[model samples]
Target: MKQGLIILGVLILGLSSCRKDPEDPLHKTPSSYKPTLVDPATIFPVGKFGMPQLPSDNPFTEEGIYLGRMLFYDPILSFDSSISCGSCHKQEYAFAEPKKFSTGIFGLQTGRNSSSLYNLAYSRKFFWDARQSTLREQVFEPIQAHNEMAMTLPFLAKRLARTDRYIEYFDKAFGSNPNVFDMSKALEQFLMTLVSKDSRFNGFFPGKFSLLSDTEKRGALLFNGLVDFDMVTGLATGTDCFHCHGGALAQQNNPDMGGIANNGLDGNFTDKGYGAITGNPADRGLFKTPSLLNIAVTGPYMHDGRFATLDEVIDHYSDNVNYLSPTISPMMAAHGNKQLKLTPQQKADLKAFLLTMTDSAFLTNPAYSNPFKK
Candidate 1:
C-alpha cells in the first residue's frame, strides 16, 4: 500500500510540473507573439511628476496599451452594449462629464460626479471616497456596478473570446487568450501612460512670475500665500489655496498630507464620504482632493457634484465653509476657521490662475482618443 501511494504521488508531481503558465506557447499563446516594448521614460515625465511606482508584474507594451484603449472605448464592455467608459468621461471636458451625475447603462445615474482622469499615475487613492488603492482593481467596480456598465466577469470573458479583435490583441499583447487578469494589466499600462505636462501653469511653475500675466501673477500670490485678512474692508490679504492643492501637480499625494480631507462642505454626515469606506466616524465627510490641473473643464465640483460652476466653488471656500462640521479637516479649522472673504477682483484673479492650469494638449491628445472614432 505504501509503494502504491508513492507511485501516485510521483505521477501527480510529474503532471503538475508539465503544466505551463498562460504565457507559455503550450497554453494556447503563440510562439510568434512578441509585443513591442514601450520605454517608461517616454510615458512618464520623471523630472516633473517623478517616476511613479509601477506594477512590476505588468510592463508597458504597444500592443497592450492599444488593446486597453480599445477596451476603454468599446461599448461591448457594457451589459446592454449601450455605453463605454468614454461615454461618461469625455476628453473635451478633461475626462469628466459636465453633468452633476454621470449617466450609466439603462439611463441610470451615478451617485457621484465622474472624476477627471489624468495624472492618475500620481494618485495613491482612487475614487472620491478613497475606496480603491489601484487602477486595475478600480476598473472592476464601474464595470460591475448595477448603474454602470453592469458586466459580469464570466459574460465579459466569453464576449471577449467571441470578438476577433480581442482574440488577436490578447495574443499579441499578453500572449494569452481573453482573460480579465491580463485585461486589467493592459488597462493599467494604458492608464499609466496618460501624462499631462503641457499647460501654461506647468511652463511657468516654480518662480517664473515674469511669465504670467499681471492678473495671473496676483492670483498666484493669493493661491500660494498664507491666509491673512485685511484689518479694513474685511477682504483677505491672502487666500492660501496651496495647503491641499499644492506642488507642481497642484494636488497633495499623501492622504495624511491633505490628499483626503473634509473641506468644511457640510456639518452633517449625509454622504459620509471616506467614513463609509473606513467605517470611522472621524473620517466622515472627508473626500479625496483632486489635482487642480484640469479644474476649468472638470466641474460640477465636489464628490456629490453640489456646485455647478467654478464661481460657486470659489464662493464656498470664500464664504460658505461650514467650520462647525464634525469631521472638518484640521487645516480648515486652523486660524479659527475664518472664511477667505475674497473680494470680486480677488476671486477673478484666483479664477484666472486656475484657468492657466488647463492642459489643452492633454485634452486633444490623439493617443488618448478613441481608437474606434478614427
Candidate 2:
C-alpha cells in the first residue's frame, strides 16, 4: 500500500511537469490573443464632400493604431534614440515644428519646413515637393533620411524584436513577427485616425453660420471668391482664393484643379521645388498648395517657411506676387500681375477668418497626444 501511494505521488509530479502553465508567458498561444478590431468608417466618417479612401491591403484596427501610436512617440525607433517622428511633427503646432526647418537627430537641419500633418488622410500627395504619393511611402523617407530619424529597417526591426512588449504588440497588430512593412502600416493607420474636421468653419455648413463674427464672415466670402468685383468698373469684391485653397478641407479637392503650383515665392527658383523630381522646367518653383486648415497655428508659412506671419502671407498675394515667373500657376496668371490689393481692415478680417480654421479639439485631443507620458 505504501509503494502504490509513492507511485501515485510520482505520477502526479510527472503530470505537473508535463502540463502547460497558464501563467507562463512562453506557453501563451497566438490563438489565445484576440486583436482589437476597428471600423475605419466609424473612426473616420464621410464628410459632406467625401472622405479619403483607406488602403484595402492595410485595414485599420484598434490594436494597430495603438501600436503605431507607441512607435510614433517612441525614440527607440531612432538610431541613437535621440528623436522620434513626433520630434519634428508636434501635436501642439498642428503637428508642425515651430522652427522653420526641422533639426534632425544629429543636429542637421532639413532643407524644407516641416509641413502640418492634420488631414493627411485626404492628401493624395505628400511633402512640400509632393514627391511621395502615399503615406506609407512618405513615412519611410524621414526614418531613413540622413537629416531625420536616420534608422534603417533592419536595425529598427532588430531593436523592436528585442523588446518583449514590442514583440507582443507586433504579433497582435500583424498576427506575426515585427517587420518594417507592418511598422509603416501601423503608422499609416494612426495617421489616418487624425481627422480634424471639428473647427468653427465646419459649423458654417450646419446652418451655424453665425459662428463667424461679422469681420470673419466678410473674410470667408473673400476667401471663397463669392464676392466678385467688376474690374473695369472699379467695383471691388472677391479675393479669388478658392481656386487653390477651396473645399471644406481648404485645399484643392479635384485633380483638375492642379496639385502643385509656383505660388511666386521667388522669381529665380532657388530650390527648384517639384522641378527636380520630374525633371521638367515647367515644374520648377512649383510646390504643393498646402491646406489652409489651421493656417493660424502653422506659420512661418510657405514651403521654405519664409513668411513668419499670416499678414506677410496676405501681403505676398495682396501686393508682392511675381506674376512673370515662367512656371507661374494658371490660377496666379488669372490675376495678370495685379495684386489682391486688400485693405488693412480686409487683411485683418482675412486673418480672422483663417483663425476660425483652427481645430482646438484636434490639438488637445488625448487620443493623439504622447502616449508615453504617464
What TM-score quantifies how close candidate 1 is to the native fold? 0.93
lDDT of 1 by residue, 1-374 (tens): 99999999999999999877644322673649799999888898887778888878888999999998899888998999999989988888889999999989999999999998988888879999999999999988898899999999888888888899988998899888887888788888878777888888988887799999999998999999888877787678777779899988999979987899999998887899899999999999999999999899999999988999999999999998999999888887885788887888999999999999999999999999999984
Give the CA lDDT, 0 to 100, for residue 161 in model 2.
71
Query: Number of the top candidate by lDDT?
Result: 1
- How accurate locally, in lDDT, is each candidate? 0.89, 0.82
Residue runs of model 2 more than 4 Å from their true location after superposition: 1-31, 206-208, 226-236, 253-256
Candidate 2 lDDT trough over 10 residues, lowest sum: 22-31
Q: Give the C-alpha miss distance for residue 229 in model 2, angstroms.
A: 4.1
Off by over 4 Å in 1: 1-26
lDDT of 2 by residue, 55-164 (tens): 88888878899988988888988889999899988898889988889898889999999999977788888888889888888889999998888999888878887888
Q: What is the TM-score of each candidate against the true structure?
A: 0.93, 0.88
Error of 2 at 73 (Å): 1.0
